[model samples]
Target: MQAKSRALHEFGATFLGPALHVYAEAIESSGADHLPVCLAREGWCFHRLLKRLQRDHAIDLPRDPVYLRVSRTLLFRAMLGSETITRMALGNDFSGSVLDLMRKRFGLQLHEIFSALPIELLRFNCELPKDKDTVFEWLSPHLKALTTVVSPTRRALTAYLERSGLTDPHVRPLMLDLGYSGTIQKILTHTLKRDTSGLYFIATKPGETAVGDHQALLKGVFHEGVGWRSGCTMLDRSLLFECLLTAPHGQMVDMRQKSNGEFEYFYGREAATQRHFQDLKTVFDGAIDHVIMCRRHGVTYTRGDVQDLYEVFATKPNCIPHDVWHLFNVDDDIAGNGMINPMQMFAI
Candidate 1:
C-alpha cells in the first residue's frame, strides 16, 4: 500500500485537473445549493486501475471530451459523471473491492508519533528523584551519543515504580506513548485491557500560553521511548515531555520553548527578526510563517514545584515560560526568564 501510495502521490499532479473546477463553475453558474448524489461523488479517485496497460495511451483528454469521444453520440457531460468514468477506467470493477483493499491495507499516517504501546495519560506526582542518576539507566541504549535522553528515563522510573509497588493506583491506559507500534488507534483495536481503567486513554495536545494557568492544567505526564522519535534530540526537551505525567495534578505539560532562542535562516529578510516578530504578530503578512509551532518554547511541567521540575534536566533550562509571558523584568524569577540550560536539551 505504501508503495502504491508513493507511486500515486508522485504522479498526483496528473490525477487532478479542471474537471472538478469546471463542475464547480457549472454548479455555481446554475446556482444550485444541493447537487445530485451521483454528481457529488465524482471528485474522489476510489476506482481501481486496470491491471494491464497498453504500450501507449492518452490519459490527457479532458473528462468531458473523453466522455464525448467514447460515447460517439452527443450527451450532457453532467449526465455522465464520475461513476461512469470510474467504471470505465476500472474495467467495470464497480464493486470498489480494490479500493477497499487499499484503504484497509493502509491509510495516511496521521500522528507525528506512533507506538505499539498505548499513549496512555497516566497521572502521578513526585519530586526530583532521590537516586536520579539510575533513573534513565534502562533507556541509555537508545540515547544518542552526547544526547541526554529524558522520556525513556522517566518512563523507566515509572515502570520501576510499578514493579516495586511504589506506583499505587497506577492505571495503564489502552495505549502508551512508546514502542514499535506507532499509534493508540491500532492498539485499541488490537488489544483488550490488562488492568482496570478499561484500556482507554485520554489526551490533550501540549500546553499553551493563552490558556489559563491552573494547577490542574500545569502539571505533567510521562512517556517512554517517545522523545528521540520526535526529532527533538536535546536532552531537556525530552525530560519536559516526560515530566508532564508526574506533575502534582492530572495536568499535561510539554516542552514548548525550544525555538524561543536564536534561529537564523536566509530568506528575503533576517529570519531571526522575522521569527522574533512572529509571536508578537504586529505585522499581518510579513515573513512570519503561520507554523503551528511558531509560539512553542521549552516544555513546562505543571502543578508541581517548578524548581524541582527544572532540576530534572541535570542542568538549568532557560526560565522561558516565565520570560515570554512576563513583563518589566528580563531577570524575573517567577517567570523563568533568560535561562537556557544545555542539559535541558534532550537531543541535538
Candidate 2:
C-alpha cells in the first residue's frame, strides 16, 4: 500500500507539473473570458484537483473549471443527426461481434439494434472484419437506418450544450482531458461547427493524424509524439492512468431533456466497483496531495523526469502492490472493447 501510494504521488507530480504550467499559460493568453471545461470521467479528477489547487493558492484561475459530463458514446450518438459514421468513431481496426459493434459503436439500445439489423445478423454471432474498409463496406447498407434511430439524442445533446454555455459564440472553451487521441475534441469541433482548443497531458503521433482538421487545435503539455520512440511510455499505458485518475462516478452514456426543461444524464455501470472504491480513493487523494505539495514547494518535473518515473513504476517487478494489479478491471463498454486489464499488456 505504501509503495503504491509513493508511486502514485510521483505519477501525480509528473503529470501535474506540465498541466499547471500549460493551464496557467492558457488562462493567461485566453484572458478571463474563456471558460475551461474538463471532459468527464478522467477530467473529473483534474477538475476537482484544480479547484483544490486554486483554493490553496497553488494555482490561479479567473473562474472554476466546469466538469462536462460527456463520453465518446454520447458524443458519437449526438453527431448521428448530421454526420456520417466514420471509422474513427467506430474504432479503427475494430474486432468484435456484429451485436457488439452495433451496441457499442452506435450507442444503440437492444431494441433499436434489433430493429435496424437484419434478423439473420443477430441470430449468428458474427465477428466484424478487423480491416477498416471491410467493416465500413459491410455497414454501408445499414448506415442510414442505424443513424435515423438516434437522431433525437443529437437534438437533446444540443439543448444540453446550449444550457452548459458551450454553444455560446462569445465563450471560447478550453477542453481538458488526459489524452492520446483527441476524439472528443474532434467530435465537438464537428458537431458545434466551431474550432475548439483541447489541452491534454499527452497527444500521440497517431492521435494528431486521427484528429484530421482539428489537429491544429490540440496541444499536449507533457509530450507529443510516438510513445516508445519518444520514451513517453506512459502514453502507451493509458488504461493504467485511467484506473488511477477516474472520477468516483460511472461513465455518462446518455442524456435527455425532461418535460420541465431540465437535462438528465444517464450513466452506465460503475467502472470501479465498491470493493475497489476505498483503495482507489486513497491513491487519488495521495496524488492530489503530492501535486499541491509540489506547487507549494516550487518543485516542477519535466517530460523526461516523468518518463523515468513511469518506467520504474511500470517495469520494476513488485514495485506496484499485488492488489493493485487486481484493480485493472476498467470497463470500455462505450468503445465496445469490454473490460480490460492494463497489466496484461506487460505479461506479453
Candidate 3:
C-alpha cells in the first residue's frame, strides 16, 4: 500500500506538476477571498477535474462555448438559491456586495422577499433540511414569489440545455461538482425538466427525487458510488472538496428580466472580486494547458487512479498538505456531522 501510495504521489507530481505550480502561483498572488487564496485555487482544481471527467470518464463534455454556457448558467442558478437563503438569514444586516448582486441578478428588492418569509427559521451558517420534499415545501413559496425572476432564467437555461444537446434524446446530460447530495443537480433537473444526472468528483451518498418527468441522479467518482459510504474517505478527503469547487464571484442572488424579453443575471462583486477572478483565470488557463499537453501525449487518467490516491488519504490524515489545514479546520464539525461541509469562503 505504501509503495503504491508513493507511486501515485509521484505520478501526481509528474503528471499534475504544471497545474500544481500554477495553483501555487495563484495562491501566492491573491488575498482577496477569505482564508488566503481559496477561490483562485478552486478554479485551478475545477479545471483539472473537468478535464478528467471529459477525458477519463468519457462524459462527452464540450469545449469553451458549451462549457462556459453551462457553467455560468448553473452557477448563477445555484448561487441565486444560496443568496436567497442568505437574505433570509441575515435580514437587514445582509447588506454587502453579495446582497447587491442578488438584487441586481434577480431583479427583486430582497427586502420584500425577506419580509415575506419567516426570517426566524434562518440563522447564520444554517443548514437546510436534508429532506428534499421538505426543502421544496419550504422554498416553494419563496420560489413562487420569485417566479417572475426565476422563470426567465429557467427559460434561458432550458434553451442553453437544448443548445448544449442536453435536452436531446441522444445526449446524456451530466453535470460535475465537488461532491455531496447533488442539490444543484436536483434543482437543475427540476428547472430544465430533463433527465439530468450528476457525476460528482466525490460524493457522500445517493439522494434521488423525482420532479415531474425529470429525475436527479448522482454518483461519486472517488468515494461513494451510489450513495453515502460510511468510511474515512469522506472525512480524510473532505478538504479536497473545498479547495477544488469554489467560485470567485459573490453568490448570484437573482435574475432581472429585460424589456427585450430576455433575462440577465446579477452577481455580487467588488474590486476584490475581480482580483480573485483574475487569479482564478490564471490557474484555469494553466490547468487547461496542462490538460491539453497531457492529452496530446496520450496521458490518460482513470477512476482507479483516483481511488488509489483516495485510499492513501483515507487512512492517513497527515498526508493532506499543511496549507489545507486551516480550511480543513474551519469546517471540521460540519464534516463530523455528515453534512456538505463546504467552506464559506467567497460565498458568504
Q: Pick the candidate with the highest TM-score.
A: 2
TM-score of each: 0.15, 0.82, 0.53
Residue 78 lDDT, candidate 1, scale 0-100: 11
Q: What stretches of model 2 exceed 4 Å from their correct place?
A: 1-33, 81-87, 120-130, 206-216, 227-231, 273-275, 322-326, 334-336
Model 1 lDDT, full chain set? 0.20
Alpha carbon lDDT at 253, candidate 1? 16
Q: Which consecutive 10 residues in model 3 have the weakest lDDT in total?
A: 32-41
Question: Considering TM-score, where higher is better, how would the candidates rank from best to worst?
Answer: 2, 3, 1
Give me candidate 1's TM-score against the actual structure. Answer: 0.15
Candidate 3 deviation (Cα RMSD): 11.3
Best by lDDT: 2
lDDT of 3: 0.43
Residues 234-318, model 2: lDDT tens digits: 7766566676667666677778888998888877776653346666666556667776776677766665666666676666666
Deviation in angstroms for 262 in model 2? Answer: 2.7
